[model samples]
Target: MLISRNIKMADVIHMNYFTLSVLNRFGIELGFGDKPVEEVCKKHNVDIDFFLEILNTFVDKDYFPKKHLQSFSVKLITDYLQTTHDYYHKVKVPEVESLIENMVDSCYTQKENIILLKKFFDEYKQELLNHTHREEEVVFPYSLAIEEAYQSETPDKSVIELMNNYSIDIFQNEHDDIEEKLFDLKNIIIKYLPQPKDTGLCNRLLFVLFNLEQDIIDHSRIEEKVLVPKIREMEEILVKNFAKK
Candidate 1:
């Protein structure tokens, strides 16, 4: 992973190329976060437990902020609790609540709110959920697997090289796509919440969307700069071991 403060929020995997096939297969409008785990699992053909374990890992790492119960809304927290089976209950619920409140007050109150408010919320939820699932299930596991393969006594150099090269090429390509889509979505939202619209609801919706966008960008950076490189290094180690054999 190439660590730098340079990458902005829009340059993540959705903007990249390799994951584009998966993203297109998965579709971008509805996003992966809003759908049920079972549904996302079925759609992506990922394992549920495996997915849960990965989410739990990230949550534990505080890669995600713990949902602040005192400051956040109850309903949002409750929804997350139900969805994640309390795995993120203590950490994510509060933030989820705050997001819900902001979205309801800001985005849902606009004149155009009725047209796509529900859709927006649904997509928002699905996008976050799906993002987490992808990292935990597909991306992380493959990464860890590559790392382990590189560390084994009799490392499989061919497999290590293939996985490393493919992951880097594919994941980076998808990051570009994610960025473009997010930029388009942001533009659409901004149009809907044009300036001088001082409604309390409009303010909240725009704020929430802006914050969510920031989170997505930051998360993508971590994966690209941190996770991707880490996995590649591990693959390199495996190759070195193979040479010794």
Candidate 2:
């Protein structure tokens, strides 16, 4: 079911606990009582439409409101994306790393295999860091700049030069499949890695890895499906307008 403003905040959590992370990204905490989603969003000063869209998209895999998401300002989208990056960096990555560390420490047999697993994850994490760093430092700013230029009555000539040098198509082409490695990591644990002494620890590590993988998939969907196309459209408009000058 699609989430509505009238739905109770607590009920939303009951519907999809995964949304707790989504709520956290919006700075919405757990003590919302029985307040409706709209009321809670207003209290938190979040854009209600954007919040609902994000929640629905996460809740139902088939429910991507691409046009609706594209209607939001680039800044809003980028800000949310940045918050997601922060969550991955500060919380998810560390939680996964810690679990893997615990698993490695607790397991006695096949220690070398576990160590190699850790090495693989470390490489994946570094690649993820590089991807996000480039998005934050280069892609997002360029997207925002396109929006600014598109909105400007008299866009600076520099924007044309910027677009000429770097376009959204370039970003889409260079977008890496970082989550693919997570799939391999999961397969390694599930298929190849011998059962750890602490089955619980291994299970926890797999669970965390799965969650991170899904989260990254959703994150990439928003970027590639929504943000990239929106910026591309804006870039096209800006180019045409500049050409008329």
Candidate 3:
């Protein structure tokens, strides 16, 4: 397997909110009441009943249990925002404010800079949007499916083995795209602003950029280093057990 082995279940699960928020932002909303398990389980080649059990566990834990979990419509798109508050406050917002400050100072004052900054942020936003979608629609759901399989009590190895076919189409591709976007942001910051010697505005911009970089790095670390491995493990185990038939 070309997949990283250090990926953890916690990583992907933690990112569930991130994906949901991203989808919500893009208007591709999903909810528990939407029959996500039925749709997603089918995509990932997992059993629906087993998948429901996992959802119920989350419900018991009150992970996102709205309307008393039981009353919560399974089809309703639950609030799935991940815990990126620290990342947003500590990194993303500061960096963005800084970037905005820089734009106000430089771009507005300088005609060409305005166009450049707009273009940059526009592209940046697009990349992020795409990244979140893949995670929500593919990676997170696939991981959920695997979690269901891994935890299943079925004695029939084949029943437990279905996770091997776990497929989150386009997840890997989107990962690459996100990595490239991070690099692009870094390169732009490095190339466009050498030093914040001008004023507090430049300093602010640099801060924002730095924070965005941190968030992405943190996000990627969670996804690549933590989530990927666990999913892969689930897949591998399922494959082996599935072969027992």
Candidate 4:
């Protein structure tokens, strides 16, 4: 999509491919009514500034702040991340799996291909859930503890010890690999999936895969852009101000 200064908040998806995904990621459902972005956001009860910030970040990667995660609590972002995990596990993954099942039964000639797709999806789902589990069980607790104590000006000894043993750097290094398989899943669907006897089923599968890919990308941005950077800054502060004390 060619971006231009003329692309106002009122522009519709017809005008900007990226805006539609931005709205969708924020759970906004809109038609191409060409409504101003602020009005659309107001109708959906979304904070206009936050929505715009997200959209701008999506449009321009450099727009996201590099130095600090402010204007919201780390707890708020972490809790939202947890909700994303729940949605992925209980809703998103299951919905896509069900779509595959229906396609398998309906696309008799493509059943084998559908089966392969399902197996790949199941593997991806489990891997994602496992990743979420590690963040929830180990990283989040420690991150929040550090945040909680940092806010109180009392960095706990245990959190410091825990940080020494576990690092977000490890997670950071592994994240790209985890996302790599999903990219392969998408390309296989887009390029190599045998034509389902039912075109509708094929389209549905593609829609779900495309949406899931975009959603996962947004989720990763929240983690890498917001959570990791905030934690890194917090750790730096803790070491300098509290470590020797």
By lDDT: ranked, best first:
2, 4, 3, 1
Residue 17 in model 4: lDDT: 72
User: Which digits, one per residue and each the tens of the lDDT, describe model 3 over residues 145-168?
Assistant: 665666676534543434435453
C-alpha TM-scores of all predictions = 0.47, 0.94, 0.53, 0.77
Error of 2 at 1 (Å): 2.4
Candidate 2 per-residue C-alpha lDDT over 109-131 given as tens digits, one digit per residue, 9 for 90 to 100: 77888889899999999999999
RMSD to the hidden true structure, all candidates = 15.8, 1.6, 13.2, 4.1
Return the TM-score for candidate 3, rounded to 2 decimals. 0.53
Instruction: Give the TM-score (vs. native) of candidate 4.
Output: 0.77
Locate the minimum summed-lDDT window of 10 residues in model 1. Answer: 1-10
Best by TM-score: 2
* lDDT at 146, model 1: 69
lDDT of 1 at 154: 63
